[model samples]
Target chain A: MTYFHSVKLHEDKCKGCTNCIKRCPTEAIRVRGGRAVIDDARCVDCGECIRVCPNRAKSVVTDSRALLKDRKFNACLVAPSFFGQFRSEVSLGRILASIKSLGFSHVLEVSRAADVVASALSKHLLGPNVRYPALSTSCPAVVRLVQVRFPDLIDHFVPFDAPMEIAAYAARQEIKLATGCSDDEIGVFFTTPCPAKVTAVHQPVGQGHSQLTGALSMAEVYADAFKFLPKVTHEEPVYGSARGLAWAVSGGEGTAIAKDDYLAVDGLQHVIALLEEVELGRLRSVKYIEGQACIGGCVGGVLAVGNPFIARLRIARMSQRLVSASLPALDLAPSALTLRQTLLPRPFLQLDANIEVALQKLNELEALVGQLPMLDCGACGAPHCRALAEDIVRGTASSTDCVFVLRKQVSSLAGELMDLAGKLPPAMGRG
Target chain B: MVEQAVLEVAYQVVGGDFSQAGDGASRLKRVLQQIGLAPALSRRIAVAAYEAELNIVIHAYSGVLKAKVSPVKVEVWAEDQGPGIPDVELAMKEGYSTAPDHVRALGFGAGMGLPNMRRNADELEIKTVLGEGTIVYMCFANRA
Candidate 1:
């Protein structure tokens, strides 16, 4: 099967540094032949490599601005994090109006869908026979991480479409009803915060197909939207609730649920640690876990501009100013939330396909690890001694690739050559 | 009958070293994960190993935590040399504890260690002498 990945590597700009390999949460990257190669099955598109690469070799694949001109009736689903990218003084109305001038016929708020999801989740938590410590599935990167690394916790993920998908569905329906455009004529583009959302739109995890036509990066539309800032006379009708607006920042979803026993963790590494604790069964007491791959949540997405802290502050201010309201009436049938396909474990790091073979490889890996210097230096293009051992066992590398081992072997060979020279008969004594 | 392959690893746990109490279990968990064991099974083994290790750190002078891994199951053995429990039955009780007030304050001695081990492990066995030491054996099935 062909897998869709939004993260692309620019080979010419790559320095082949081990920086991204060490930072990648899924360990999906390997430096082979002076280029970083990503194992598509393991990559969750968390954008850590994009953030860590000093040469800017990594970029996300998003729909171009020309895609907007191609569609007859273009509708844009604006993410809540997009509001945080603007200046503090910029009103949400101005931003929405500016987006409208960019040739979008309809500008729908994703936070409205978030409001519906929050309400649905609150009811689900209060309902009977619910699992404790349910995990949030809103973050595509976190969901993919669970599928890849924490397969045991797959059942713990709440079975629901993300707010973006729900908003796309709503936007498409409303655009079709109002403009009388066919599905192909109306293009619903999601203004996404990260590349994972782009991947999600292309190849959704639980659903058969995504409601979104494509994803546009916030960075792509920021300048165009900013240029048309003063074109609006009046503020458009806003439908998002205060709690929904809070979803732009970390801990917002947990706060929206108002659960007493919840953990809100952000940052890819921090989320990994939290998942580890959950996997160890140490977090049995927690009722919910909200994990975001970005540091401060969606506002800290790789495509987002401005400092995350400042963005968070602005989002918080915007949420505080909004009036509390219940979710608007929308078609939220059971069919809308049900998944058509089941998510299976990726098993990206499985040692071998056969258990018996994997066992033998594990033993070999242990022996190789014992012989290694254990310096954890990234000299051999592997992260550490254990990783090098794994690479050797997988036949991608050799034990002699270690600089220390090579040096030691060279010295020993030199000593043996000297000893052999001394042992040779006195033929050289005349010289 | 074919002989099943097994891998064994051991760690030393120092007495009253609260900071390093879970080190053995943590490493064991990582090994289990790397070997591609089911997460639920790995978690069960880790929990049992951690509880046994903590018991040794809090109550015993010193101990060795050993993990034996096979395709079928994972076995954790903790042997400690220190003052042993006089009543194995009482020690197994949920609320019964001989831990000092300071230890309890530090949240080390909740008397739930053995019970938690029993709850997480598929099979648990405890043997103790009044003065010499204690030994805990826990096994978890590596179900796919």
Candidate 2:
């Protein structure tokens, strides 16, 4: 029952203007005591709050450079989105070399793992028991969202380790055999674009534990990579296929798998809509769904630098340059890429622990909703009237907390006072 | 331990409004989920409700989809004023749709509606008046 969240609210910086609460896909946030509070059970760590918070109060929890310096042997597992942040002209080799200069012993590209995932996914799709419109499990936020909001569709999720997890395993194995270090001695760090990856590493959904030691934000590593790009002399061996590198942007997985009826949706809201269609059984014709939490895939991550469109363009140019090249032999064992454990649904919004109690609450909620004006105005510090009713049932709020309801009560009391004055007070004053 | 309480909610379905066809079922699904029903049970109810909703939209003039929830079972009653099916047995058969070609072009009326609903619901009862309308009742057991 341990909870690990990558996004944290900085108390001093939070203005509690209800921006994050309104934008949060899961309604996991509440503005209480003039500051935003995140419900750990409901947060999926999509970093949407980090993106929408005007005061920059929302920030990611990541491993610092000091932690990297302490490791005996450090290996950086680079997300393909990392390449999109740099100039299009920069070679992948130069980017790899630049990452090495940031105090790392080895640099591994997650795209290579993505290639393995693409292969595994194709094989899974060809199986007789494959679920129709199987959802991609690569995006941790998407997986968590499904667990919370679309529990019945959990079986539709393709059971496989994400490219980051696979890359961390491969990177650790390579670094271990080369340096003859113990597992604890080699720190495998992932350069992540979103906070969900950080949460994934710390509290993995389908695995016993993450192979990665920690995650470093792409934004945090960008400046160092840029400063050292020209200084590196040694050329790092290329490991990623063109199709694999394409995983950094939206539609890349569907395209790489060569599925004609696959759907690729980006942005948290769009993904939610697509999942809703899937829930309604309207997407029966689709073979697979690739959902990314960010608008333009990993390139549009909250922690990523530059505009998403520009980053996507750069990634596309990079893909075009490498598409014609032959793929290298994979260095890791293919069997290691499969997920070791099953992911269970996380029903974050369950009405109550007891079903009978929940039904009673539902009745109470219905009664309360009937009494309130259905104006979804966020005047009560809750997102909507329905939400306020739920809060009232939970004993976290009262009906009078609503400004409209309070105004009605005040006006009615004033009318009663006026009527009494007309009847008795006027006679006493005249006499 | 006390007598189970049944909570009922009614939705008005407009005919030929493709955009709003699934709204009733979707809302019902959310309610079931929030009521702490098992996912499998909730899904079955949702699928049955959706198919029934779609049937009214495609063939009926207008309809009312009502969902009743209790501790023992979840029930959906869909009644519509439309040209009733001459043969309920034929209507229940897969790929036996009588929808116009235009409806077929919209990717619906492959005639899987009633069959799919039957497949998901534990109990189904249909009542229709030849020239007037049809009423379909679906029930799902709320087993722990």
Candidate DockQ scores, in order: 0.52, 0.68
lDDT of 1 at B34: 71
| Predicted candidate 1 versus true structure: per-residue lDDT over A139-215, tens digit per residue | 99999998888887888877667888888888888888888888888889899889999999999976478888889
Give the residue spans of candidate 2 off by over 4 A.
Answer: A323-327, A420-430, B1-3
C-alpha lDDT of candidate 2 relative to the true structure = 0.87
Per-residue lDDT of candidate 2, residues B28-109 (tens digit): 9888887889988988888889999999999999999998888888889999999988999999999999988898899888
What is candidate 1's DockQ? 0.52
Which residue pairs clash in candidate 2? Answer: none
CAPRI accuracy category, model 2 = medium
What lDDT tens digits, residue by residue, belong to model 2 across residues A1-431?
66799999899999878888888999888888888988888899999999989999999988787777667999999899999999898888889988988889988899988988888888888788888988898899999999889999999988788999998988888887888888988889999999999999999976479998999989989888988887978768876577788899999897656667788999999999888878877888888899999999999888898788899899888887763333364566656877766888888656787777777888898899999999977767787889889889888889998888999999999999999777865447665
Model 2 TM-score on a 0 to 1 scale: 0.96
Q: What proportion of the true contacts does each candidate reproduce?
A: 0.41, 0.50
